[model samples]
Target: MTATLIFLLLFLLGLFLALRPLLGPKEPFPEPPRREELLEELEVLKREVEALEGEEKKLALARMVELERALEGYRPPEPRPFNPLPVALVLGAVVLLGVGLWRYTLPRLPGETTVTARAEARELKALSDKAKKTGAVEDLLAWGRKAFELGVYEQAAEAYMEVLKKDPRNVEAVRRVGILLFLSGRPEEARLFLEIAQHAEPMAAEGWLFLGNLYFQEGRYQEAIAAWERYLEMGGEARERVQGLIAMARAQAQGGKDGKSVYQARCAACHGARGEGGVGPRLQGNPILKAKEAVREIVLQGRGTMPAVPLAPEELSALLDYLDSL
Candidate 1:
């Protein structure tokens, strides 16, 4: 409202300036102050000169002639009224320009943020349609990128997941999908995707940041510290925040911890939410729970399709106790 008022004031001001000159006195130049005095004197001399004769008349007549010449020199030109046609044309043009500028070039009616967001929404929809129609990795990536930039996590995840289906090795898709998952509170799934992305592209600072956060949530304090340190080394923007997280993680490392919580954080994502099994075999009532040493060895060393899961002594002990309970 304030912006509209300001624009209106400026528009009115422009019209005022444009019309001011035409509204002024009709004469282009002002009459000189001395010209009126000269004219009055000339009129008086003319009336008196007619009554005179001889030398007196001759002197008076000469004086009258001199006054007439002076009057001629002082004569003001006729004032010309400003032409209405030109004034009207100029006014029409100015009004049209001001209206057009207000509608197009000036600040929008609502707010710039609203205007920009609406534009983004339209572009996001276009990109999403194109991606769905083509099913191409590039198009999907473009859509995902737009959605991610706009903070629409669900749409971003949909697009990136589509890209991953087409190209499993797409690092950006893996990383972005992981970020979306984390934001949606699916930390376990997020961890899997994030791990893949971070390994494929170690230099990505944002990936490391989330990776650190995932580790922190999982009670893997040492790993969290390392990941956050790497993020800082890579020139992450949230230096102070990451440093604080690292300090907190360090504090957590020294504090007492929970075994079930550790297992859920470290193993539940792949194994099972409740040990019923998914990617890895079922651990619930499994014979492996009775063989603690063998399970520990398998966890520490790569076996079959499973990768090594290195853990600090305390976290490893906690995980083992939790696994036995399973």
Candidate 2:
């Protein structure tokens, strides 16, 4: 509601400025030259005309006639009638345009957030253009980072992929590309790149964090636990979060998985708590939930960013029951 008010205020202010010229005048009074002044000037001109001759006299006479005409014509001009029709039309157009833009072009976020996003978008374009022209790996990396942060995934992919084409061993590019692929719902490919990145730079803590999450999704509890440990050891941020994950992985490994618990521990972080969707698709209302066999197969074999989540038969049965509820 606050955001909507700010937008409305801004729209109204702009409309006011744009229509300022059309508002006409407030007084509606056109003050012509004073009648006494016109008569005085007319008398002075007549006296001058008598003293002049030929062209000079003719010029004076013309001035006197103009002055007399002004005096004659000087009944205060009538003000134009106030016409609301054109103004109403303009208002309607502005309203229609504002509604159209609100529906399509404007961001739904708060006003400040929307403005910041727009600014970042412009910067992203500038960085992209410069990087394209330079063809430098550093330039591309900068552009890729900006794009990724802005959630312009395709552009981010383009920038990172370009970096790979030029420098295949670039650790940052490799790790980030892997992360992008993961987010793009291609966990299999994401894992390959992430594995290469981890091996190439084991000290890269963030890579370990994601690699751990990937492993956890696959139900490789030990590997996930190990990767997360590595991440913690490397002093990756989110220490507490990773520790929680390690605890969960331990539970899963020990066969303590109830269906809802399994979903929370294995999938909630990515797919959203209520399965409304985040990094993965919304599980709620998904038709696949009705297909127990298909859901089981997908969980076991992995699909998209999900690696095979190998639950024990009992745990799997419980998970299927929980999924059916979703």
Candidate 3:
């Protein structure tokens, strides 16, 4: 709206400026040079010539004759006629330009057609058509997972729903639907569905993660921590972030401890005092942090030659949070 108004104002200003010279005040033009003044000057030169004697007198008389002749012959230069063609052309161009600018700048009205932004939807539709043609569970699940990854919630939900319809016991489908429900703000239903999925697949890291998040949102800090712990134990890769989440939850559950202290005490020996790496892999800018759940699982179960170093839940939480910062 503001842009449109500004364009309109600019167009009006251009129009006014273009017309100002042509439509100026009607004051009479300045008087042309008077012939009488030239005549008087010539008469003065004639008197001076009479007073002079010698070559100066002859030059003066000659100049006086030239001036008299000029006065008699002089006529004002003719005014060039005003040509309206240039102004008309300029006005025509301005009008055309203003119309073009206005057309482009004006806001679109409601219900007006525009290029659609439904690439994901179109892709999902193709996947659905394929699933329908094949009538295969794997194909449906494939579409569901892809849709979820793309954040096409409706399509993901539809695919998952279809999976559930075919196999009610499909834990992955149930877990995903629960996640979608949680995202859609139906927490109570989400909890029921998530619990069912988690119960069916206790070692499913993703399910536990979602359940933990759900518990956290409900202020069930202890439950959230326990769920996240199970997720880590089950080899979830988002360990660093989940550990920080646990630390935050613990702070809400019981007064929090300094995460740095936990890191120095528990991790500094193996991971280095500054997390630059020692006996263990470098913690600074670690790729595992990017896959934090995987990192959490490694911490919980121990990886390669590293022994599982368990601490109090609070301390573990703090340590995870500290490591994530590194």
Q: Please, what is the whole-model Cα lDDT of each candidate in the order they appear? A: 0.81, 0.83, 0.80
Candidate 1, residue 276: the lDDT equals 93
Write model 2 residue lDDT over 63-169, tens digit each, in one string: 88888888888886577687777677767767876875565444532233455665676788899999999999999999999988777889999999999999999
Candidate with more favorable, higher lDDT: 1 or 3: 1
* Candidate 2: pairs in clash: 187-305
Q: What stretches of model 1 exceed 4 Å from their correct place?
A: 1-113, 257-326
TM-score of each: 0.45, 0.50, 0.42
Model 3 global lDDT (CA atoms, 0 to 1): 0.80
Best by lDDT: 2
* lDDT at residue 101 of model 1 (Cα atoms): 56
Candidate rank order under lDDT = 2, 1, 3
Residue 158's lDDT within candidate 1 is 94
Kindly give the stretch of ten consecutive residues in candidate 3 with the minimal lDDT sum: 109-118
TM-score of 2: 0.50
Report residue 175 deviation for candidate 1 (angstroms).
1.4
